[model samples]
Target: MSEQPKPLPLVISPPRRREKPPRHLADLTLEERQERAAELGLPAFRAKQVSAHYFERLTDDAEQMTDLPAGQRVEIVQGFLPGLMTSLRTMQADRGTTVKTLWKLFDGALVESVLMRYTDRATICISSQAGCAMACPFCATGQGGLQRNMSTAEIVHQVVVGARAMARGEVAGGPGRLSNVVFMGMGEPLANYKAVIGAVRRLTDPAPHGLGLSARHVTVSTVGLVPRIKQLADEGIPVTLALSLHAPDDELRNELVPINTHFSVAETVDAAKEYFDKTGRRVSIEYAMMRDINDQAWRADLLADVLNERGRGWVHVNLIPLNPTPGSKWTASDPADEREFVRRLEAKGISTTVRDTRGDEIDAACGQLAATES
Candidate 1:
């Protein structure tokens, strides 16, 4: 018998130092920006001027900042608003209306953001963490484990880049403003609670501080992090909260969302109810329809019952067809099962809709390409 080939030796590379310039406006709040500008020997008002260019004008090139002193424009831009996203690759589908970009960060870390342009609006999906800690068996990013929580600025910069790209008509179709933002990429938003909230503020604050998008236009999804859910409700922002409840029961949820081990289904539902009570904004329950796992008719009925008992008219169910990662046993539910799931929820007087799947061709379902590349 031929001898088996020797296994290839594993080679480990030292972490690459973060390259590119360091100034990132997304990392600072309005006051902090002013403070930094003052320390840099620029007037505090310069910070607001820079912020207007970034948030309102959606332009970063100092040359276009005609309002600033000609000589100081370059220094202000370079010292405070350095480039954060370097587009490494872009893949488009849905007739170019949906585009996914793989960006190489200053640290050489690969993260992705998707810009989906529709008839009336454009939405950008941003990342909260570099990888993920949830470790859901069916998820691509989770399998990679958590690298680190992205700074508030890093998270907001993703949106600004997408917004700028859209406004400049760099994406397919003509230029348009980004209307919505979703934290549905790469990492769990609630896991990086403080930074995610800070990013939200930066996105919603008016010009000279943030992108000026309405709070209602932002959606933050979590895998039922109970404490964070309560904390988010208290933040006084009315951004929609989406709970990624893959399974309705404790047993299956424990297997699918590992955090369910700490907070049971009952506790999670109660927390969801508390959020609604506090914010008066309808909570969105996101269920990914996995074939043969959480797609059974009984689970659907149970999901309806739980929502009905917890609170009525204060919750919406968003059914997502599973976007299977390569080599994963989990797959999307059949059409028949998906229809039945919706029917059961509607029967309970709960509002329901299937999420429009976009950018599938670009591995848009978070961390799939990054994991494969890594």
Candidate 2:
């Protein structure tokens, strides 16, 4: 008799022997930076100086760091800010308000970030991993499988570069501050929890120690990493949590998000609610509106019931227009269907909003450009 096929594992552990990224200052805390400087035979004060130039002044170029002594400037910058990534390609859309950059990491892994400028704020959606292991069939990054978990510095550098562009007015609109960061670019952020949390700390830490962005402005999205969601709630940081719950029922979600098979819909939603209860930060439920797949009007009502079952005013649904990949079967839901889905959710008192789909011309869907390059 043929044995039944074994079920797939929930987490795809990173393959062995992947080369680690170069160590950078952003990977270290302020005190650790001082200790490293001492080991380099440089005074402790130099650490703060270089951090000021990089974090406060938004420059990583050693030449621009005139405050450091000429002899030690190169050593300090090289010791701490060794080049991490270089732009392989950049595309602009939305009348230049949205700039997407494809960055080649030191190990030749490619990841992308999109800097979006709005009337009131500038937000950069950054990648947490070079590729994803979540294996969401509709996602480009997940199809590519796991490359390697990104180093803490690699993740944070994306934001710093975007911030620099905004400060210099390189990304359309006048010089402005980067007010928000979203971990919705390429990978399941919580799967790389330690590094993601470190990056978050660096982002919210004060200038000279970090970028100093407010914790409230940071949002980390995961594909229902239930245990990690609970762990994040315990952490004092109150960054918003976004659960990419494409379907509200186990039958559909198991196929849509394979991880759901291990952690069922009820378990995932419960953890998300616990996060909200602990942090007092409302959770955002991400639903990709797929044509004839998970976007039916009934699923909207079911999703509303799923959330309302937990409690009132604890979650909001952000509907994403499915950005179909090249030659893929998945596509965005029809306008009428999308509108009706929204109406259904709102009718049940679930605050909902359709995500502003941008940069289709620039291959803005996560990992599309990188997949093309590969």
Candidate 3:
């Protein structure tokens, strides 16, 4: 039997604040944008135009939004977008197809975003917070500690930035649109529930107000925040919910994912089932495969049993290959063990896949670059 890894540092999550983040137009609704426009002495329609440029056009540069008054372009851009975060560095992989960017927020907090372009579709992995509060021992970001909940605008900005880069032919595939988004980056999204939902709206709502992407294409991941999961289901948004259920049993989960103490494995899976019922989207169980730690064949069977008990076809296991942080005792499981784990789950009639860990040289795992840089 293998010993459980040492418990990592944890942050007691404070209550989510109702206070709004610093001003950026992406944070505002159409009505709010109009109100702010009037207050800024710009015409109400001007707000819509700026939004079209940002959301519809995916470009914040005043020069590109040339239909607007030439002199006023700069003014509106400054007042609305204002460039909330600056790109400190960008590292690429896969022949410049996979790009990871490290952004410095206005307050100097660091977060990361990754853009992966394939032949058929492009996906961008975005961070919901500067750092994470959920102390998942194997996660690099969780180990670092939570910095602050990213604003709705801050979250949307990452998508817009990635989209803009794609449109600019910066990536290998010349000028394409970002088709999918995964909240699998830095923070536990549900921990910052309100802003993440707002970001979802900003990403999926129709043009002039949002990027107009489909809700089905968007995925919001959580560390099993039960109430928030229920709240999100009621929101009528059917974005895919990915639960970070790293372990299937409460005892090991309690040690691997400290939040399991608050929401047990049984209750967490129950919440996930509820989400699937409400949204009609299958819940993704994200289990990070670690060497000699929670990666045994029996654990995989138990995971399948748990999901099967919930019912088949409502849950899919996404086995994420762990990217161990520097000097970490835990590491990814061996290929043979990983294959066997997958076989056990499939034999139980549970769908499973070993996720593609892209951007290896660029530190693909969340918070690695920022954690190292900071």
Candidate 4:
């Protein structure tokens, strides 16, 4: 028909290439970075130099790295140190002693870290994943669902950035050192096993390889990933293991920590005991007190009984007041209920303390602010 408008040859265009995700220095291990530099025709030692710049100096700028050859600095920085996190917003409270920053990763994934300064120490709470896979109903982060596991570098970069900020006197009360690192920010630390462990090494390793912080000052928290917990125990690094055990009995724990469905309370507790036996570092039992939910006096007694049965030493209970996320029905227990809960645990000869609540004003609770934005 009309030369059939002989169908023009179909010309298919190649699909547009997807942009590579932004690379943070924290994403690579020392060996991997050395290999990458080799691929770029740079000397093996250049990787160590770059690491020193990023980890010790806390600067990715090639110009600032006087130690590296001027010609090689640009390529090293471009090839190995692409920006990984962008600060979105920061809020401070508690007389500026507590500062929380919301960061957007290269892929638009968001996580947060809080830097709290005390007279004696400074602690940075870091996230192991972009969001949480553990659907703890009361937690804001758990509700957002998991986006992806953070790379080792991504996890370590959070601490490096915080450390840099502290060194520069950016946070309140002038210059300070990052004394502690806690995996209590967002996501389950054990879920992303390899990367989390790699980050731990990078954090505790000596300068040129890591920030060189002591392993003892680091704490890794999990919602009781039984097998992984045991695996961690075998790693030989004695970082504190924090078990988020909200409920003492199986019935409530099963609902509160869905993973309990996979590993029963007894099994989880046994795993923690194994960890204690291996590392000799007392495990921290993290209990978030929610009104009428798991705060009943009887439940507290049951919790103490379980801990006592496990043995008197090598475990401590850190009672946290539920930081109610926006629009959530869960609320913190009344003062009397909280006091009684602690009293019961102590009566059982268990050491307990109410966790100091910080960052309340700035969605300081792990996933609250990020959830709202997402």
Candidate 5:
């Protein structure tokens, strides 16, 4: 009895907050908008007009908001719709079909968002956190450590800008609305749960209040935050859930995804299964193929086996070619190995596909460009 030790205390990491999120259009509720409009001494109707211009029309340019009186346009724009970010520089590849824009936040925090133009549909990849708290050795963003959790408005602003660019036919493949959004940018989205979820709501909510994007077209990715995964399931959102399962076994995942120490691979999959069960949307397993690191054919078979053990009709695998970060020893798997990895997964009845790389020429590896500037 004397030798028995006390149980380890449960330590919950507080969500990091460096600076307050600026009061902007995307961060406010419809009622809050009215309140802010009143505070600015503008009629409540002006709030609706501003919402239409910002959320639906996708233009924050005061001059462009002509519905508001000429003198009040700038005031309305400056009041509730104060822009949260400015594009620093934009780079392109694939004949300008892949565009990556680095954005400067009000607090001087840098984040990136990429818009990919395909003939069928356009997709935008946006950052949820400024840097990242998860110290995944293979990721460039993790190398710098977490700067701050991006506000819901900060996350939504990136899409609004992309939507505006698409509307003006700036991106290639002609003018089109953004058909998809992926939370696969600078940080672990689930780590900033509230802001990420709030952004999703604002993206999916109907017009004049939100971007009106389809919930199904949005994908929220996490590096296996088990509890958060379960929490997201209960949020009643129908969006797809993508788990960044870089490795199939705990032993390897513990190294590739540092957070795996808290939530093992099996636990991660179980949580994903819960998501699928709740939403009726299949879980996407994002596997970044590191050359000879986790790219072995045997590992692929093990990955397939693990997914198969969870049963079928609930999970799909997206095998990504690792985009080499500067000076990093990790690199993409050989083409032949990537093919074999896919073949092995499919052979075992697990649905899999090699993800198409975008913005490679521009070094669109999330925080890679910003890290250089710093």
Candidate 6:
């Protein structure tokens, strides 16, 4: 008999690092920042001042920090706010309400983030890593494979940048606050667990210490990293967990999201339920509907059954219409099929909603622009 092909090794952690990104104030806790300032022979209050400028005032320029002595301003800013990532290119759609930016990290690794402004709230979807390790076949980020994991500050900077844009009225809307953050950009957030958690803390901590966003307003996505999901439940942070369970059955999910081979659909769902039980935060089931693949009416029934069997009211099904990559075989599901799929789930008493698709013209699918640049 012909031998079955060897399975590829899963990248649960990033490969060895080449060089680490420089430290920034956002990466440090308040105490650590104060200690660093003392080591630099500056007053500890300088640390809080710099934090205010970055997190509160949304300015990194030393010149804008008039409170500090002119001689010390440059040193203080350089010590805390070394440049991290720069916008390589930016594209906008939805009348400039949806802006997508491709960022070049210090080492030239590329990532992308999307800022979406709506009537009630402004949201920024930030990347946790330059590329992804979860080789989910349908996702642009997963197609490119993994680069080095990003530092805590690198992830937080994306939000600060987006928040700055909103605060300055750079987006189509009038000046507003960035109220939401989703770790659904270019990487598997859980795979970079430590940095992702640090970023979450930095974002939700009170002003001068961090961005002060409510933990409820943050969502972190993972492709069934079961252990990480469990660890997150015990972290005391109530950020919503989004499990990208693209298929209901193991046989299909193993192919769609490669991580399923390590953690089965049953195991993944169980972890998600435990998360909801512990945190009282409803887990979001993210399923991208691909035409004729995982989008059939029967699969919808199976999905509802899978979720319902876990117990009700602990999950919400978010149906995303697949954003097909250029020349990719997968395309968005037919409207009729999508409607039927939703009908089946709703009929089964599963709370379901179709996602508002945005940023198609600007390659808003996480890693598409970075992939294109490469």
Task: Work out the TM-score per prediction.
Answer: 0.92, 0.98, 0.95, 0.92, 0.95, 0.97
Give the number of the best model, judged by lDDT.
2
> Predictions ranked by lDDT, top down?
2, 6, 3, 5, 4, 1
lDDT of each: 0.85, 0.92, 0.89, 0.86, 0.87, 0.92
Error of 5 at 181 (Å): 0.4
Candidate 3 matches the true fold with a TM-score of: 0.95
Error of 2 at 71 (Å): 1.8
Give the better candidate number (4 or 5) by TM-score.
Answer: 5
Error of 4 at 36 (Å): 1.9
Q: Which pairs of residues have clashing backbones in candidate 1?
A: 26-153, 27-153
- Between prediction 3 and prediction 4, the one with superior lDDT is 3
lDDT of 5 by residue, 54-121 (tens): 88989888988877889777777888877688889999999989999999888898899999988888
Clashes of 2: 0
Between candidates 2 and 5, the one scoring higher on lDDT is: 2
lDDT of 2 by residue, 102-136 (tens): 99999899999999999999999999998998888
Candidate 6 lDDT tens digits, 1-374: 12322344655666764888998998999999999898889889999999999999999999999998998889889999999999999999999999999999999999999999988999999999878877777788888888889999999999999999999999997899999999999888998999999999999999989999999999999988899999999999999999999999987887888778788899999999999999999999999999988898999999999989989999999999999988788799999999999999999999999999999999998888998999
Better of 2 and 5 by TM-score: 2
Error of 5 at 355 (Å): 0.6
Clashing pairs in 5: none
Supply candidate 5's per-residue lDDT for 373: 71
Clashes of 5: 0
